[model samples]
Target: MSTETTLIKQHVIDPEICIRCNTCEAICPVGAITHDSLNYVVKADVCNLCMDCISPCPTGSIDNWRMMPKAKAYSIEEQLKWDVLPAELSAEELAAAGAEVGAAQEEAQAAAQAAASSASAASTASASGFNSAAYGATIPPWSAAHAYTNLYGPKAAEKTITATVTGNLRVTEVGKQDGQQDYDTHHIVLDFGSMPFPVLEGQSIGIIPPGVDAKGKPHHARQYSIASPRNGERPGHNNLSLTIKRVLEDHDGQPVRGVGSNYMCDLQVGDKVQVIGPFGASFLMPNHPKSNIVMICTGTGSAPMRAMTEWRRRLRASGKFEGGKLMLFFGARTPAELPYFGPLNNLPKDFIDIEFAFSREVGKPKRYVQDALRDRAADIALQLKDPNTCFYVCGLKSMEEGVVMALRDIAQNAGLDWEAIGGALKKEGRLHLETY
Candidate 1:
């Protein structure tokens, strides 16, 4: 092949479908994936076609590829500015661009080989590191309902679906005047009047916050886990809900406004917003009768937990489904900080078993979700033994290690082979972790 016929297989993330979940960036072994406030972009020069970021992506957006002339491969800066993936180069266009068909075939085979080698090296390094993301599954549960995604996005005929704010209510308590920390979480509901948007439990939707950033470019959409069941937040309504916490302070106690969080939390009833995606297929709930669900989450992470629980609850309420055990291990700084505290307590023990961990209650020891999991190791061990049980963990990235470690210890103490069990969990799509 002549030098001009050299073709490069460029890996890319689909900005339209991408939720900016940061999973791809975190999993990329070579640090080739990066993001600005606008979009996540892959550095062409650094990427090794390793495929590490492909499976961990909940949105399926990281699997995109474009064949380009070696000299004309897209730059990270160009990819960052994309609202949608550029059109694929047809055979004629490729040839005109000086890439022969046979050369393209050779390039693809070479790319595959490179991907396999990089994947092998990544796997070996990952085995030595305690990466919880390694345990995440890419496939949906066998009994999961069909999920609809990317119905409206930048590349679609309709750029976005307009959702009207039906309701916005504060779910947590207001802080006192004496410099008390405010746990300001809002339960916002949006109604799509006539849009054909369908979603499932554990899925997410992207909200394009109004206005541009400091760079004067349009704000990229932000993904939020769906907090409502598949039926609807209000059954039979063409609507859904999200649990959003206003970020008045950063992790270091420094005040900073979260562009997306603030935009979502401040929405009033009847306000209009642009939305994209019903992203995520893997994190869905198991729909088979007697399929047990083990949900572990914290703060806003409870959004998808609520979706799954409510879905199961709705099914049980219908009296047609004989559901299995539903277990929830939820954590918060205090009882007051917990979302749906009143409603969660109101749930019948026969319907769902809930364990609440309060880390900052004045009179109580700082019990976290992992501590709560260990406290009920007997029950957790039983669930682990059951082939029908599926475990779901979602929370801050800091909580992932401890929660997974707790499960590992529980398995080991029960004389279970963790390697086999963990492998089975991933292979069978029984264990899911979503943290950022």
Candidate 2:
């Protein structure tokens, strides 16, 4: 076997920061990404470093990379089992490992060469063919107001800040009388007393739950999007709101209560909680006058959308800003399960155009946010062609593909070149996706 030494950069997910959003997995073109209940992992051998999954990741956990000998790279199984990423092998250790696997090193070298060549070829081609527009905006809209991010957290001097739980109320209607499905969601307000915690509309905050997990390690912070405007949840106060769903079961329907959700849901007034972040610099709304906004979301994904909408509402109410069209396509299992249903109805039709899609509404055909988009294809197509229009998609990971495909269909049906339009959208930062 040839003794060619091959160096490769191995991408790994940071388990500590990852929220298990599945955004990276869904956007990965080569199926190099996969996730378990606890972790999202990248298969090193399959990943060609296309950089497609990097931009859409909400937490920046998917940005970790380790450089080592090709033969010493971690496998998918190894990554899935890791609680924390393994320390990078030293130069001597990498050399020893490579030497031990003589034939394996040759195989790895071949694979590395093949992957590099493929990646190079892909780099030369236009990325518009990959439907990257669906992955969402990596950069905020050009006209967006200044946002303060990472003001506090792991990267900052202060480890964490404390916030008082000023308000906690159930947003979704749930009870035996409501239905068999007891889906619970809460609108939580946090007040940062005498502290400077500046946050923008699309940013998120990390809530550190009280105790340790089953592994006996301190529970890592969980991120929730800011659901209220920058001014405050109630206006002119140092506070923000979050829309948190009480997760009673796992994605597989197994009875596993979520750590953070349960803790946040059970919070009482005046209770103090440890907080971090104001994470996310992208996925923000346009602040320029008459910049049309389109929001598509489901469940708690409505948090950021609500923030932007409320901010717009506040701006419109002030009569200082002449706003543009505001359209929302929100989805849920049913009307009762939808958060902020009653309040959403009270908004004037002239201020915003709202459409709800409920997949499990009794006696009605199943519908989703994508279906709503399709129903309004002509209008969406017109918006897509507008230079001032910006689109945002958030919610479940399952919705990303369908919503993106709907945009593609809309562009095509309108006699527009999807590649050109998609390229322009991404280049201009007009489309953003935040599905988890």
Candidate 3:
């Protein structure tokens, strides 16, 4: 009388040959591989057997095998229900995790204070802004003509404009929500009219303009991930919106301005700015029936998170999506710097696991997103068990190592094989890093 269709089971990973890259953890459309501080295990129920995670492994350690003949097949409904944890953690677990974060916060605060004092002393002795000569050579936004043409196509009509004192555009909405500051959220409207360029979620676009930098030279074209989902940028619509933040400093602890970010931050609603590209290849989300996503980011890196979340939210509201778990980890200098603070807090807190690490806040000395991951090692490890889980990390490049280190610690603490877990992550693009 029961008409539930059974799903097939399989052994998609070969332990003997696995190199432990953690790729599978980050790439699986569903969170299926349970990775810890030690070993990466596959959770069969959530595994769709799509085999999308096999190709990215560098050492070919993953081996896909059918479930044994004796094993009972489970229905899709049953499979979907397999890994759903109670969404409740014991009071002890929550307390321990909170304590760990508190300690880390203190350390981070101390370090930030030290750095701030040093910076203040240095600033008093020198010019407030960056010294243009320190950098190898500065280029104004206008000099990058080639970058502009490449993004819009070689034959596209070329238009150039410079940013001036009177013409400078002030930012308006910095994407604010409750418990969040009025951060710099600038909205740009792109009117495609009849010649609109379309983009999907996860796609990136390039921007090249004619503005000159402080060095009296043209600046370079910059690339940013398209935050708007494809559905939002539909045809016949004259405009597209982009949420951007200005990059104020370079990675080397030196004062340097980002060409695109600075210009983007200073634009008005009516400003006609040069635009190019939607250029990215390996970092898109799968639109498969029941895709799972594990997103990790720091700072303004939450842009992509916003895109993917918005897309999923739309699908959920329509009741047409057979979606999987959506885990998001976002880090920032302080709670104040978080991009989508209020909305992040509002997401079905049950479905979306939000973790925070304030690097400069008073309590912590140098805490980061990775540290938060380590604190939640058990839950994270369990998520990795689902071979369908696709993990994504974006934000500061410096945070990559820390995150990896935290994963390693989680594996060790959980008795997982570190090499195997890490290998699977890299092999499956489960450990995507997009820090620049």
TM-score of each: 0.87, 0.88, 0.57
Full ranking by lDDT: 1, 2, 3
lDDT of 3 by residue, 148-218 (tens): 11235212325322211212222333433233323464444455545446565555555565656454534
- Tens-digit lDDT string for candidate 2 (204-247): 88888878877786777788999999899989999999999988
lDDT of model 3 at position 212? 65
Residues forming the 10-long window of minimal summed lDDT in candidate 1: 119-128
Q: Candidate 2: misplaced stretches above 4 Å?
A: 1-5, 98-135, 154-158, 176-181
lDDT of 1 by residue, 1-436 (tens): 6656678788998886777898787656667888876789998877788787786676678899988787788998899888778999898998898888775768776976877676644643444466666666768788988888767774452678999999999998876312654548999999998877899998888898888878786777788999999879999999999999887766567777888999999899999999888788788889888899999999999999999999888888898988999999999888877899999999999999999999988888899999999999999999988989999998888898789889989999999998778777878889988887
Clashing pairs in model 1, backbone N/Cα/C closer than 3 A: none
Ranking by TM-score: 2, 1, 3
Alpha-carbon lDDT, every model: 0.84, 0.81, 0.53
For candidate 1, the TM-score is: 0.87
Q: On a 0 to 1 TM-score scale, where does candidate 3 land against the true structure?
A: 0.57
Query: Where does candidate 3 stray beyond 4 Å?
Result: 1-189, 212-218, 233-239, 254-257, 363-366
- Candidate 1 segments exceeding 4 Å error: 1-8, 29-31, 43-46, 55-60, 66-108, 117-121, 176-182, 250-254
